[model samples]
Target chain A: MDRNIAGVTIQVNEEGYLTNFAQWNTAIGDALAAEADLALTPRHWEVLNYLQTEFKNDSPLSIRKIGKSGVVDIKEFYQLFPTAPLKTASKIAGIPKPASCI
Target chain B: MKRILILGAGTAGTMMANHLHKELSPNQWEIDIIDEQEEHYYQPGYLFLPFDIYEPEDIIKPIRDFIPHGVNLLIEKIDRIVPREQYVQMENGDRLRYDILIIATGTKIAPEETEGMQGEEWKKSVFDFYTFNGSLDLRNKLREWQGGRLVVHVTEMPIKCPVAPLEFAFLADSYFKNKHIRDKVEITYVTPLSGAFTKPKATTALQHLLDEKHIHVETDFAIERVDNENKMIVDYGGREIPFDLLVTVPTNKGDDLIARSGLGDDLNFVPTDKGTLQSKAWQNIFVLGDATNIAASKAVSVAHFEAEILTENIKRFIAGEPLNAEFDGHANCFVETGNGKALLIDFNYTHEPVEGTFPLPGVGPLRLLKESRLNHMGKLAFRWIYWNMLLKGTHIPFVSTHMQEAGKEFA
Candidate 1:
């Protein structure tokens, strides 16, 4: 399924997750973040980059792992993306939706 | 005599039954409680069921054993409430009229609310630990688990026992370690919230503990569907999380009878006045516990507090006098952090839980927002209190309904 946001036809799943990670680009990421009322900051991008890097390596994404990677602490991770750091970070990073156990 | 009808016989309802039976003169009012189930559940104990920490005998009891001598207990499924007519329609084609009504039917897990959550993999792979049968099934599965990605997921919030899922993860960590397969299991905690908990301070404290356990946290992932064939859960943004074993807390909603009666919100929770514990829609009706859309955790402590004030107001309302008693949205809960240690938090409508000593000023047998062996002991000892004191409407000696700020230090 595709959601046309402000002239961009982005493909999303039934639940609105991106279908093809390959098709995801910076424009699509910015458009998606806007839908969630988030403005991307350099720090947000840092978390997103970290998510993308770890996900590419097939390492499980968790706050402890990310903090241990020396990117950002969990508190700052929540600060950069207030409500949901992992899911929002994954969406912004154009990776598979992160399922949590909290 | 005027009829006082109570909807459920759960924790809140049972407590109210006992409380009101003594307060209202038997000649002036007829107190009656109705529920379909014959057994009462200690819902907090469900968290331990998966790990075999509690036996069925410990939590289950005959509902009739709790009701006071004078009150009437009706065992029947409710069809709908005719509040306009001041009567209830039961599934047996009987109508129950009431001078005053109390809705304590409570919230339940709605697995069907989420897409594909109750599909082919339900009970086989995907499971919920919210019900008695669900716990039994999970226990059976956990007994033989060599272990893989043991994923614990919450579909949405406003669930009964908010800290239960976290406690489950903590207990699971201890469970696997004790089984000598701790290294074999990769545990992940998935929630839609930003951090470890709803409150900021507790979130940081819990996140610290999660980090210590080497457990992963996945945040802001709203589930879209459960792809059972693929053994994965997909989120709204199309992110897929695979699991070898999936434990989910499905969406919790009030009884369908609430929606059928047109007294509920979009999620079937009745709109209740937070302070008075009275129904905003109906003058003679009241709601408590998981059935109310009050900004409070759907906990037994909140229900107990609400019952205390509501009982007082009900008496006031009957006498054509002013109802002055109030509830401050007080919530008290224990978080089990594994290895025989737990944390206790006490907060209300205005106060967030902080570092504190409880029960006595500057002196507490129990600490708040910090883990101690004492708190875990309290959690275990609570089972005795739930049965002997709480449900019987016996007032706890020192713990008042209103939260006291004397010993707590705000950060």
Candidate 2:
């Protein structure tokens, strides 16, 4: 899968699961981690895990609808994730290297 | 002595003319306003015209009557603004020189921008409320016509008063209901935004309201063209929404004079410092209201808030004092939601519409993000305030230029 957003390139599978994690070394992930300015929390991790599982199941979750499904309020979910949860989690998971992250 | 030239004697321009006329003395400064049309329209009253709440005669007044005696009122089309030469050329091959220029040239519907929109259906099956003529034409059509699929559409974002489209939809629901044809007519709202509003929180609340009213919503629909022959609006994604009566807020663009002058953006809006209202192209030139390429909604209330800040800055510029860079994207809107109730929304650049009380926070006569009868009354009362106090440059009591955080109890 070829994914490009705001001039960044990413190659992944149909489920957006990465076949090549080696394409993005730890240095880029560490750099992205520094730039995001996010404090890693269990709740944030739970969302990332949920999104990864959803993507693996060949279904992309609607961030807003998911929020309204009782996990969190839509506003709080946005506060947690300004960009899309899938895109942000993809960066953290190092599944497909975000062009911006790289 | 300074020669100040203002373009378009519409709501924003008229208010600014009244403001400068009151602020500056005749001996110290000379003011001139240029507009092609002689009639001044009460735009807000257009919403009520279709329902016979406001007479067409009541909404119009002579432009010259409102302009003060000392100011030069040139009822002519502007050819172009030659800012480098500090003058604006008129259609009659005459030039009016200026020491300072204020651009309050507001926006209006541009139907030609959309494909097939201005064709056979225009003003017959289709109408717009932005213009006085369109409203009157729609009124005549709605009077004798039976109810059908009434589609209230917004062509794109940054249209004047975002809530007005929703208000029209709500009012249509009530109008058909009153006429005993509520069951016959189906109301639908089509917006380009992801939800009902551009803001996230307000979108959820307004989406809920839309559901409660049984109004169907088609979101994220970028209108490619109006398929007039098929009686449907075709989106780029091939989504065809049928409508019997298409009331659309056509693409709103700045005055043609801006495009002719070659000083405006792709949409013909002048680029200005978002906070200062100062023109990016020239130091002496300033812009206000819908003419600027600002992120805020192009509404009269925003213009009113911006006028306060811009007036102060202009005074400073005249005095050789440092300009004050302080204009929050303050926009306040009253959303009429049928059944004698309305919702008030107060927001700026960063803040979205939150559930709270406005004007006095906890003791608000108006509630933000919630429907109330008092808000409806306030919406009705504004037309009186607009003509009497607002246009006269008198500060409205209790309504501040900036959004006050005092009274609001955050959700």
Candidate 3:
């Protein structure tokens, strides 16, 4: 599998598992899969859906509304998402990590 | 011979050390400073660090470099301050007697105070920018970040530089936008305080800025815990904020030494006279910076103004003269709104951030309420002013110790 974004190369294996989304090119979608340690189900796809919309629109997607987007349960949505994913997403987007992050 | 002991060589203690060293005669007075940390951080620089504007080396210098020659610098952990006996106990089993004590031990991040805040996700998914290490970790995270639901949460009140959380949100907006991944990152600002700021008037103004930047503000959220396994922040009100990334300003409290001394209020800050800054429990003890329980923003500007007033009072107390009923809680801060523009706000205990020009009333280089590029430059320039002048206890020419009303336009 391959994803389209400049300077970002996402390659997955036969099972659509991320094989190499290297340090500099890792996408939030790929990071999410890594964070779960390849245990991502379609239920985790709610996060990917939210991220897709957020990236497509190039703006901050609302947490509450995103929760109601029917991807995940409202209770579980708050449970799964942390500041790390958003930060990782930025990294996955191939944006340079801030100095404070280092 | 009178001895003055200043605790913690951070901004407030460093200023007091420099101030007292200049005022008191070495022949008559012995000055000493105590702190365990070796590095003196230009804290204001931390706000600019994550954005790649300031290098870590630029923000940090050896703590000893800032302490002048005349003063004795004791690099050791403090055990407790025996205010009644006018003596401070050290962790190394030594006691230092002081005629007068300046408690500037400052505050620290206590993530454990909130459940799950310091779990496996900390510095991974959840991060804090308050500490140097935290900021550095965040830098690494942001560098490799692709973007997701980024929730910037302020755990509770009494945190240092109340505006920092909002600044992080604003800076993040600019950071991602510049990287061409602004589309991929979703930034949300979460605060326990209502609106974007602590004060009502300023909150309104700051909320407008947040709205302008498209950073969603979740107000009145008292965070219960950071569920690391689940990766969400749950509030006491059952309000849950889900984020792909969580940047938190955890519960800020005074030094653990204060708890040992049994001198602080419920929040672990010393109970100080709002006007005098003198510890209510002890006449010889004074608290400055983030260690005091004052209704002021825990920013360096407030500490700078407080230093001016406290230094004067310290002199009077030494000379057996009447302490001045001054110090109007003056705090002036520059808020970065990104894209080479910032907003300057100056207010005291009574007033809010009003619309006006600063420094020079009619022809100020810095604008208030309204954003300007000049104000952004002023914010950038302050790191120099803080080290070379402010911490040295040298008086700034145009900037008065008290909040000036000449330039501000009141509605």
Candidate 4:
């Protein structure tokens, strides 16, 4: 089903992750972060941008990579996305889910 | 000639087929094994399914492939066993008589025993990964679930692969972090035990892991019912913990056929001599694995160890000699702590997990009661060893069924 974010119909899966990256916008990001009960922070966006950029570059994301990404260290990475960093960051960043996630 | 009939072609039964057939002369012993299911699942792999660590194709294999060629593999449901007469009545109406019976029929997940657990939310919100189909269903459900209150619970103890629930919680912690929804989902572990594990020393070590992962634990909570409508589980004390998704290990009990045969206790567990694995009620009947009321943990490794001791005693029983072998209830398991790391624990009926090196004294390998990458590799590599080495009843070099004291530290 599609969700309305800022009066725009955005594609999403049953889990509320954006199905199409192109359909993602700031309004959708706001809505996703709101659903996660997390307020958008500059540090959170740094990791989100790193995840999004890595997805665009066709590079795989891992805890080790994000920990060394300079934007957020391993401890801070967990702090930003305490549940799951790559999957949550990618979803909020309008990227596909990682393969390693079970 | 004597007939040896083994029930349930699971890990224990399969091992027995090879172990006994090699020892008992073909001219003197005719062995037969029966199981309803065509597929044999590596039960440990079930713990990884929901987390997407292992796939269905990776764990399941045909039972016929595992059963030794000399033994007759009967793929039929058992109707009932006439224990006194020493014969099992097959559902297809065959009365197979046995001179000696080995009941290796393993325990099963009894979800129906728990009230409201299988309500409207069953396979929807409430899930179990104990069974083959249940694991596959849970895999799909977990993939679609964004993030919410993820509760990993155990209805009671004596569940197969006792460490599996903790492994699930650890993998779930890693899975969510990789997903970047770690904060979005709240992971809690609920068990009837007072601590993270049964053993005291291991409990302290594992409890630290739980606390490290920020996974809240609800201890000693005897569940009354699952309030599916309200998305909460109600304990007998009227305590309720709400969950967006409930992954539970329901009450595990032995096969009902044991109960029907009047050879089992109230929970359908066959009471057996802990040392000999021989059935207490009948001289000719023996039991092992999760089906037996042994003091050991219900683990595949325990079954493998029991198979060794039982095989030795079975030979003695056949030769009109005394059964002298003993099983010390030795069990070892790799506790996954996520992040491509795991902890190894080795213990027996008397010993809890202790800090030390394993197998070789002062050898620089395989640390115990502590996390290491080598232990993680060992955990992953065990699946191969389980099928090829363990099932073949081939003795693992330097590894004994009994727990050793050489390299272990008491403190």
The estimated TM-scores of all candidates read 0.82, 0.80, 0.79, 0.79
Weakest ten-residue segment in model 4 chain B by summed lDDT: B192-201
Model 1 has a DockQ score of 0.04
lDDT of 2 by residue, B265-353 (tens): 65678878888899889999999988987767788888888888988888999999988878988888888999888888887865667
**How big is the positional error of residue B330 in model 4, measured in Å on the Cα after superposition?**
0.5
Segments in model 4 whose C-alpha atoms lie over 4 Å from true places: A1-102
Per-model root-mean-square deviation over C-alphas: 11.4, 11.1, 17.1, 20.4
**Cα lDDT for residue A53, model 2?**
56
TM-score of 1: 0.82
Candidate 3 residues lying further than 4 Å off, grouped into runs, are A1-102, B198-200, B203-206
Candidate ordering by TM-score (highest first): 1, 2, 4, 3
Rank order (by lDDT, best first): 1, 4, 2, 3
Best by lDDT: 1
Q: Candidate 4's error at B205, in angstroms?
A: 2.6
C-alpha lDDT (0 to 100) for residue B339 of candidate 2: 81
Which TM-score value belongs to model 2?
0.80
> What does DockQ give for each predicted structure?
0.04, 0.04, 0.01, 0.01
Where does candidate 2 clash, by residue pair? B361-B407
Give candidate 1 regions above 4 Å deviation: A1-102
Interface RMSD values for all candidates = 14.1, 15.8, 15.5, 18.9
Q: How many backbone clashes does candidate 1 have?
A: 13
